[model samples]
Target: MDQYSVPAGPAAGEFRDRSSKFVAALYHVQDEAAALDAVAEQARIHNRCNHHCYAYRLGPGPDRWRANDDGEPSGTAGKPILGQIDKAGLSDILIVVSRYFGGTKLGTSGLINAYREAARLALEEVTVTQQLLLTGVRLAFGYALMTPVMSALSQLGLEMADQAFGERAEVLLELPESTASATVRELQAAIAGVYVEEVGDDFEVEGLTVLVTPTGD
Candidate 1:
């Protein structure tokens, strides 16, 4: 399956009505147990609520996951929230909706609408992108050629994660999986013809860290 992007950490939002309160929950988790734990924790924190319904997807595994409506109707709260996650094509995500009664009891349909809308609204506040396999390349260049090289790299759509200036300038770059090889080749051809230096290893880049892994390890 495709590795789509979801939020990396927990996010939350609240919606209120004259007689009901809805809290939306979203979190990124590595496994079903973790996802359930997060939901349980959130439910515990908001235990005073009338209902705590949850949905989650844990990627493809024995841990693909499940959802529960707590005490609400069987399909009202949990299923609709799960539908929102599936519609977004997002996995490794968990969402829980907590409702507090304000002297009025919303029927099953109303509960479903409130939970679904709350989940949707919370997702709208998040920025989701495709989670690409990122590769990092370090380039060292003399002062005279630095600007041109940097500009070329930028135009190639490389993410400049870090830079350090000294006798020779060093730059850390991130390239997506589809373009990593081509970008590396372009960089070598562009610099080898003009400079006398070595280009560093091609490795996976995550956030500010560059990681090197063995072929089977």
Candidate 2:
């Protein structure tokens, strides 16, 4: 897919029932690693919480998702949170709900409702934005081709993720997937002595600490 909806930034929501407190945290994640990092971060922040239930969906695939009840009833916490994420039609997102038991038992139905409502509330506070899918490329060339390669990148409005100047110069790039092949062909045809190869699917804008919404196509 060219683009998909993701949270604009971090958001939080709270729910209280029978004196029990549920805190939900929402984050934009790029992959499973990022999702797990978010989960760990939440756990650390709520270290005293009774349980830290979480759910995450990555990419556009149906199978790229996970849910964890984290001590609540098997289906009570994690499933409800995931349901809210699916209902929102979002990807590259994670939701973690930390529960502080109030000494009163909410039972199965009550627990489910609380988690669902907490997740929904957190999502409601989020501003959704489109995340552009990009393909990664690595370029290898002699020092003589550096000037032309940089010029080509500038002309094509492409961003370089990294550059190394060793015996042979190397540059990393992020390109829109739809035009990645054409871009490679154009670069090779225009700049001889340069080798271009696709590295992977994931890409990040250089110097960006947070997920960015690329403007235009």
C-alpha lDDT score of every prediction, in listed order = 0.70, 0.82
Note each model's CA RMSD in angstroms.
Answer: 8.2, 7.9
Deviation in Å, model 1, residue 4 alpha carbon = 1.9
Model 2 global lDDT (CA atoms, 0 to 1): 0.82
Regions of candidate 2 where Cα sits further than 4 Å from its true position:
143-172, 190-217
TM-score of 2: 0.71
Question: Over the stretch 104-190, how does candidate 1's per-residue lDDT look in tens digits?
Answer: 767877888888988887777666655445566666667777666766665556667788988877787766645665567666544
Clashing pairs in 1: none
lDDT of 2 by residue, 1-217 (tens): 6777888899999999999999999999878899888889999999989699999998766888999999888999999999999999998899999998899999999999999999999999999998777766777777776777777777667788878788877787777767766676655544543334432234322221112222222
Candidate achieving the largest TM-score? 2
